[model samples]
Target: MALDKRFIGREYGPFTYTIGAEKLREFALAVGGARPGAGTPGEPPAHVSPLLYDARAAKAGPYFDLIAFPSFAVVFAVRPFSAAIADPELAVNMLMLVHGEQELEFLDVMRPGDVMTTTGRIENIFDKARMSFLVVSSESRNQTGKTVVKGTWTAVIRGG
Candidate 1:
C-alpha cells in the first residue's frame, strides 16, 4: 500500500536534549576512529582536534570551551524524524525502509550544558518508480531559542 499523502505535514515533538561534555568527547573520538574502553572515551586520534576533546585547549581556543563536533547535532536533531518513522499512524514497514539521505545545516556551535529543543514535521510524501519517499524537516534551537541546526531527512520504502 502506498503511504497516505494526507499524512504530509504531520508534526512531531519539541524533543529536548542537554549536551554533556563527556558525550561530546566520546562522539568525536568514535567518529574520529578511536577505540573506547571501560570508563574512557579512548585516546583521541591525532587527526582529531583538541577543541573537540580537551577542555583546557578548548578554553584557550576560539570558542572558549569544549565544542561538539559539527555532526553531533544529529544526536538531538534526529528525534523528530525517529518519532515520525515509528509513529503508528504512518503504518510504515520498518524492514523495507532505509534512510535515503540527510542534509544538516549548522548555524551555531554547540557546547556542554547547552539545552536543545527540536521540532519537525513531515514535509512530503510521494511515490516514484516502485518506491515511496518520506521527507521530514527539522529545526533545533538552543536554550536561548537560537536556531542551531536545520535538517532535511529522507526515508525510502521499497515496494514489497
Candidate 2:
C-alpha cells in the first residue's frame, strides 16, 4: 500500500531525546571527529556549565555543532522515519531511496542537559517521471518549547 495521503499534516511524537554531552561527542567521534564527551575529554568550553561536575567543575569547551558536519539529524530521525516509511504495502525500501534534499532551520542550539523532543508530519508527496518523492517535516524542540531545529527531508520512493 502506498503511503496514505490522509496521513499528511498528522503530527507524530513528542518523543523525548536527552541531548547529553556524552552522546554528542560520541556521535562526533563515531564519524572520526572530536571525542569530547565522557571517558575521552579535553576540557569543555567555559560556558558549558552543563558538563561541570558540580563544584568540581573542570571547565567547559566547544561541543558538537552538528550542522558543521552533514545530515546529522539522522541520529534523531531513524525511529520515527522507520515507522513512517514502513507501509508494508508500498514495496518501498527507504534505504535504497535517495536523499534528494535536506533543509534544517535552527531556532536555538541544543546543549548538554537539554531534554528535547521531536514531532514529524508528512508535508508533501508528488510523483514525477518514474518515481515518487515524499517530503516529511519534523521539528525538534527543547523542554522549554523552543524549536531547536526543524528539518525538511525528502526521499525518492522508487518503483512506486
Candidate 3:
C-alpha cells in the first residue's frame, strides 16, 4: 500500500496537556538518571528552578511538575496520531511499525495547573526498499498560545 502524501505540509490543532511534577520524576527515573533532575541537553533542570515567577522563565522547567516525560505527550494527546494513521491512504501497517527517530523541542515549560493542547500531522514520507519512512509532527501549547513542546516523530513502516 502506498502512503497518501497529501498530509505533507499539513498542520493540526494545538493539542492540550498539563505538566505534572510526578510525570517529570517518572521520566527522570526511566532515563536512568541518578541525578535529582536531568533533561535534554541545553534544557534546564527538571526540578523546580528559581525562575518560576516570570511567565517567560516559567516555561523553562515545566517538565518538572507539568510534563510527564516527552513521550507522555503521546499520551497527552493520541487523537492526532490516530487520525493521521487512520486515514484511508496512510496504510496502517502495525507489524511493520518501527520508531525511527524522535526530536523534541521545548518552547516553554508547561506548569501542572496550566492546560495544554497538542496538534499533530504527517509531515513527509519517504519510500525505502520494502518499507516507508513517515515524518509526523506535534505541537503542544497552552491556552494562552504559548508553545510548551514541539515534537517530530519518525516512523519506519515495513511491508506485511
- Put down candidate 2 lDDT per residue, 6-68, tens digits, no spaces: 666655676677766556655544554334645675444444333232222323334443321
- The lDDT for every candidate, in the order shown, is 0.95, 0.60, 0.62
- Span of 10 residues, lowest total lDDT, candidate 3: 48-57
lDDT of 2: 0.60
Model 3 Cα lDDT, one tens digit per residue, 1-160 = 6566666766656555666655554544445333443552223346533333223444555434333444555556555665666565666686768777878786665455667778888888878787777888887777797776777788788872
The order by descending TM-score is 1, 2, 3
Off by over 4 Å in 2: 1-4, 32-72, 77-79, 87-91
Mark the 10 consecutive residues where model 2 has the least summed lDDT.
51-60
Best by TM-score: 1
Clashing pairs in 2: 1-89, 1-90, 44-60, 44-61, 45-60, 45-61, 46-60
TM-score of each: 0.97, 0.68, 0.64
Find the candidate with the highest lDDT and give its number. 1
lDDT of 3: 0.62
What lDDT does candidate 1 reach at residue 93?
A: 95
Better of 1 and 2 by lDDT: 1
